[model samples]
Target: MCEDEKSLLEKAKNGDVFAYESLIEGYQKKVFNLALRMVGNREDASELAQEVFIRVYKSLKGFKEQSQFSTWIYKITTNVCLDELRKRKNRNITSLDEEIKLEDSEIKRQIEDDKPTPEMIVEKNELKKVVSDAIKLLSDEHRTVIVMRDIQGFSYEEIARIINCPEGTVKSRLNRARLALKEILKGKAELLSYEFVK
Candidate 1:
């Protein structure tokens, strides 16, 4: 945390709502993205992101400053997502019938050439679905590590802190997660063939 962030934290802890909002502004997207990848839906991700902020607000007073504030928030976010996943698992609910929306910011482009044609857009959507489905198939541990390291771009040390594990464990889990995702995607080669074979 820099001096500015420290100042913001001080104000927020003293009951400045604007300061609190400002402090979290930079992390909201990352938190939501992490939740989105973990839960596999926009609606659930939105709700989970809100819940993470609420938990942050409630626990802010107890923050010891022993670690980076971002790390602490990420830890909370991961826990909330994993808990929700566990609930869904216990309920035996897996819903893939709904079409996954392709928000402009959420859609990642490969080449970034000219404006996408309709066919390109359709192919992108299909590819996104294939990847999302494969991620959803991962176990909670594998999925969490992959999201933190790969999707969220956290370093291995940072991920170890966020997930409260050894760096070696994070690396091991990430390797296994990558292999698992590859296996799942291989089974869906048809989905990627048209989109990627160019």
Candidate 2:
């Protein structure tokens, strides 16, 4: 965290609502993106993001400076996501795999290529959907690892801290998750046309 954020955190801890909001302003998109990927739906992601901030606000007073404030917030985010996943599992309502669908804008946001031919754009969209769907098919552990490391671009150490695991465990899980995703993507010829799989 930057000095400004650190200062805001301190003020927030002291019950400054504006300070609290300011502290979270920079992280809202990241939190929501993580939630959206974790739960596979916009509505649920919105709800999760709101809940995360609420939890952060309530827990701000207890935050020790041991880890980056971002890490602490992510820990809370992952816990809430996992808890919600468990609830969904217990209810046996639906599989998470079937619930997640990435919007075109979200997919496009992840890719930075300039304008392409219409045909190429369509192909890219298909590829993105295939990739997103394959990620959803992964187990929660694998999905979480992929989302944090690959999509969110967190380092191994940060991921380990967020998930409360050793760095070795983080690496191993990420390797397994990558393999699982590769296996799924191999079945998709559209993705194969791109250089990412190779």
Candidate 3:
């Protein structure tokens, strides 16, 4: 963390609400996106993101800075998301068809084709939906590794820290997650039609 961030963390830990908000502004979108991927819904992700920040604030004083602040925040994020998933599992409620809203810039980043043709736009949207659905079908462990390493772009070391596992285990789990995702995508005729699965 930079000196500026350390100052902000100190202020935030001292009960400065504005400082706390400022400290979290840079991380809000990322936390929300991670939660969205894990829970597969905007409403739930939004709630979970709020919960994460609250937990962070409550626990801020005890933060030992042994890990990067980002890593600590993400560890909280993944835990909150996984806890919600466990609760939802018992209830057995999931919605696969709810459209996931991503900014145009984010869409362009994730999709290789930069051309803005109407056909390409529609294809990109469909592809995103297909991939999101497949990801939702993964087991929690597989999905966590996939989202952290691939979509969220966290390094294996960072992911291992967030998930509290060995770095090699992170790599192995990611490999298995990719294969599981491919298998899930293969079962989707829509994805196959899009040439997303070989």
Better of 1 and 2 by TM-score: 1
Model 2, 63-160: lDDT tens per residue?
88876889999999999998898898789854323433332111111222243443553576766766776676666788899999999999999999
lDDT of each: 0.79, 0.79, 0.81
Model 1 alpha-carbon miss at residue 125, Å: 2.7
TM-score of 1: 0.81
Which candidate has the top score in lDDT?
3
Model 3, runs deviating above 4 Å: 94-122, 190-198
Candidate 1 stretches greater than 4 Å from native: 95-122, 191-198
Would you estimate the TM-scores of all the predictions? 0.81, 0.80, 0.83
Model 3: per-residue lDDT, tens digit, 1-198?
888889999999999999999999999999999999999999999999999999999999999986789999999999999999889766766432232223210111122334343354357676687689778877788889999989999999899999999999998888877876776566554436467534
Q: Where does the lowest 10-residue lDDT sum fall in candidate 2? A: 103-112
Return the clash pairs for model 1, or none: none
